[model samples]
Target: MVIFIMRITWLLVASIFHAGPGGYLQYVVYIVTSLGFVRQSFDVIVDGIEQSIVEAHNNLRPGKIYVNNGDLLDAGVNRSPSAYLNNPAEERSKYQYNVDKQMTLVKFVDNEMGPVGSFNWFATHGTSMSRTNSLISGDNKGAAARFMEDWAEQNGVSKQKGHANSVDFRSLHLSSVLPRRVSTIIPEPNEITDDLMQLASSYVASGGRRLAASNITRRIRSTQENTAKFVSAFCQSNCGDVSPNVLGTFCIDTHLPCDFNHSTCNGKNELCYGRGPGYPDEFESTRIIASRQFLKAADLFNSASEEIQGKIDYRHTYLDFSQLGVSVSTSTGGQQVVKTCPAAMGFAFAAGTTDGPGAFDFKQGDDKGNPFWRLVRNLLKTPGKEQVECHAPKPILLDTGEMKEPYDWAPSILPIQIIRIGQLVILCVPGEFTTMAGRRLRDAVKNVLISGSNGEFNSNIHVVLAGLTNTYSQYVTTFEEYQIQRYEGASTLYGPHTLSAYIQEFKKLATAMVANQEVPTNIQPPDMLHKQIGLLPGVMFDTTPIGTNFGDVSSDVPANSNFRKGSTVNATFYSACPRNDLLTDGTFALVEKLNGKDWVPAYDDDDWSLQFKWSRPSKLSSKSFATLEWTIPEDAASGVYRLRHFGASKPIIGSVKHFTGASSAFAVR
Candidate 1:
């Protein structure tokens, strides 16, 4: 039986603005995990926050904060490919595939010391890893965060002179915002074979020692020390319609661009794919894109001088989206009431975005439903007349809200929250919001916050939309975009008035916050923990080959091998399933350098240069092996180094056991 498990975690949003004893502002670091491909559990988030609090307490000192935003268009639209293919040159030129280039940054600076930490907000999708990627990664944004934090550590903290007492923070913990631009230039199918794609994916995902490392080192070396225990967050914004594949989409087979309306090649989407800035080499593309964002953020951080001063406050509440009534202004300056429909996916949703095209006959801009697929949809659940009329222009493919036999397919209840720090307001949304949708929401909320303040505030009120925060409700597109029946519109679970409903709800919250009024709590979502099911089988046991033992060297580096910078050193060992223990706060592999008589730690699994890959050698046997690869850096000191692997083995009857292995020393010159 095929089962789809929607692992959704309903987490309570933490208060970012907190005051300590003596009313001093306390720094609270909240890390937003990479939500692409991999999902972080609630327990993991709580544990991470708890750990961050301890670290922040030691490193972060309360300081003056500033907020500023700059415009730098590093991302483009993936849907533009389809528009270019389907429309005339003049018509295509008229279409504006909006790219939100605004990079907002919040920096905490100490008056006596220097820079403490920074929080950044930008809209760019994490799909730089691509769908063909098998390994888990943080994509471009994650890479940027690591680079900034590492740069801060190596140059800002440890290398600073004469400010040792003020910069006593030992470690830096990085957290990023989750907003994304859905557009990215992906590889053409024919241009890159599946094996080559996976290989490139692994190479990039492994944090290859390429342009990023050298560029970061040079940039860090050129900068002066001002930041201490610096934490950087690349948070998400309204990116439901954004794509990182900036180069546009094309047909791999014909080398022609895909159809603009449907994003299909010869009426089929399987052969259509998008391309990024660095084509052929996705890793290079990822680095280029990440570097653009980081450089822009760095510039903004340096120029930021607007001080944020006001009381810290926040308001949160959950609301049932199904059949929620919202009042919107009419074209004639009047108000009208409209209701949202139950969650349902449309046909165009199956076409997927240009970043990752879907299989079969489905295509984008498809409004009419297929007869055969309708039969299949009915076998699951049929949409009633109200639902059909409610989601007009969107041909229903899955009546997810009505289907509850096995479990809830789509969320009906979601959290809507607003946080305020002085004049900066963050609207924490539950799902992806398209470009125009996000703009409208921001404008509406900003207007409300200003007007509701009754002349207390002016045009300086900064409103930011934080998308995909509490839960996933798919996408939210503008009403006009909804009529286009594109992938974003089709995936918008609610009706065309979805964005309108969100604006209404957020305005209500904003007004309440400005007036110090209390809002009533609504119904809570059902807990699906008891209904959860695991389809993937667990590790029964682990064993080595007949003559080999666990942690035994299967493949070792060549004897007396001499390597230079930008080279990769590899070692393989007979291993067990890494799932036996997650090794949280631990290392799976390490690069140790010889220091006279004793070996000292140089790098661990957390470093971008090191990659740990696990695989089963045989299908029938429970035999596994792990390959540890370390990409040499540009600033490497000429020294002897060795690789070490750590793992755990589980037996069918007995308990789990841990083991370690090491490789022979190799020289780096």
Candidate 2:
């Protein structure tokens, strides 16, 4: 029953939070993926663990320290060597990491327990999904966080001390963008007005928040209503019987895994079993059924555990992986000094996953015996000659780490972080860690804490690896996986011992914390701030069509109009250059509700269901337009609503200026 609820909750998240412009098509793919089904259950288990921690430490002391000071997100200079032309050094200084932007204070909530909260603050780096997608988007992780923020705001929790930043609450929004093959795309539907769509989105966002808030019990109850609503609305025709053929063992003849039996896999790989698209596939169905039986059989441990008093502390530092060496445990009963190579990827990195197969004649999960791969490897791998030998078995395709003249191709300077609250410890990894690598790292951290010289830490220390955080360093796979030469293995930039090296460094950190000693400072990576560059030019200028003024409402819902359930609302405006002002911390548009005598914000650009699209009427015209839209769900309460657009215009030689567009009042009944 718990597993069933978990899968349904994932369906809600995939369809709402992570939905790109893909909409129904994307929904179908995710709902069917077996990976989503299984991994989502794990997410619930993690949540249960978290809830246990909260329940255990009900009366624990609130933390006095708030640690949101790492690289949260900043629009800084692109310091890649390729960004510079004539004078790389001079142009680079234009974009160095400023002290002000380095560690920003986004929001501070002073409470009786110091500052005890963690907002769904967006992670400041890219993931493998981001590297492949062309459209600008927040990965599933960020999208989930965005949903939490939006939901909190709607429920009057935005700035309320007891909401997102509660004195005794902390939530970890894990990314479940699954199937490992396809990317979730947010779609822009032209059906409804922005305000109506915002209302519809409130339904979904509220569902996401509930899902985030659930443990084992709450999930079971919430899933029935929320999941049914999502399927009814998004599934359209198939409603209750949507086909799960887009992924898993059912998706035969596709590039993704189809044989859950593992009979066809070369090495009988466990990863090949029941892995692919769709929820409740054969493997998942069986697991869910078994879980239900277990829940029925064991009622003794059903209640929440004793409250735990968790401590909240975090430490962050910079590490240069270029030449860092560590003593790794060896099978021969000794430790070996293994140094990480400069960042680089192999030929197989381009051979995308089975869910979304890549171009060319390449296929992943295969050895490098292919003639073409060998030829490409010999040609591209040998030219650099700088340090190709270090990242062996990877068949170095791009020696980005060693290439320095133009700009640093890959990051040598990366952020390493450890977040602790009570017995829960999160190793905030800056790179993607393969499944095995993550497990090993988690165990290593736990062991280090346990083996502290004086055993000063808590007896029950739990560790989880949170990857692709703070900064994007790329992939980290184990030596065994790296030798396999699959996409993840090839993308393991720092070489075979990357995982081992990370474990070693984390152990050192654990030891320091245990002994209550100051952390040792490592060599700083090269400063790209003075050497980075930006290729994309800034916005030139903005102008409306000859007669229209900027922010003019070109089209909108009728004045004093009424809309019904399952309808859409839309508004068009004479939009300006979006680049003129990125609106980093603000909204491009808003859905406002008429409350008493004043208007209240209901939704903004961050809402996935409310879309703001920018386009030009013609190729030769400098004028641009934006069509803001929303799809009203059946449950939207009858009320008066309006859409507002915020835009920016840059004159040829003048500073950027802001403008506004408002729609006529409308009613949803």
Best candidate per TM-score, number? 1
Compared with the true structure, model 1 gives a TM-score of 0.81
Predicted candidate 2 versus true structure: per-residue lDDT over 1-669, tens digit per residue: 001011111111111112232211111122232221233233444565456455434534432222222332221111111111212345236644311122211122334422222222121122213122333444333333343332222222222333232321121112221110001111223354557544433321110011111111211112233221110000000001011112233232343643322112333232232221224343232222222212211111112122224454555567878777978778898988878888877765655443233446553444443566666655533435546678877666667676544555667776676766556566766666654466567677887888773554555554545555544565676676566666666777788788777887787777776666666557565544444333333467878766767767788676556788557788888887776655544667676666555655555665544668788777656788888786554434456667777777878787777777667767766
lDDT of 1: 0.68
Residue 465 shift from truth in candidate 2, angstroms: 2.4
Q: Write the per-residue lDDT of candidate 1 for residues 31-107, one digit (tens) a residue.
A: 11121111223345557666765565556455677898987675646463332233234533543546566878887
Model 2 residue 488 lDDT score: 67
List where candidate 2 sits over 4 angstroms from the true fold. 1-136, 146-320, 326-336, 354-357, 369-386, 413-422, 453-455, 558-561, 594-600, 617-621, 633-635
Question: In model 2, what lDDT does residue 188 have?
Answer: 24
TM per candidate comes to: 0.81, 0.60
CA deviation > 4 Å runs, candidate 1: 1-46, 53-61, 78-97, 110-114, 157-228, 330-333
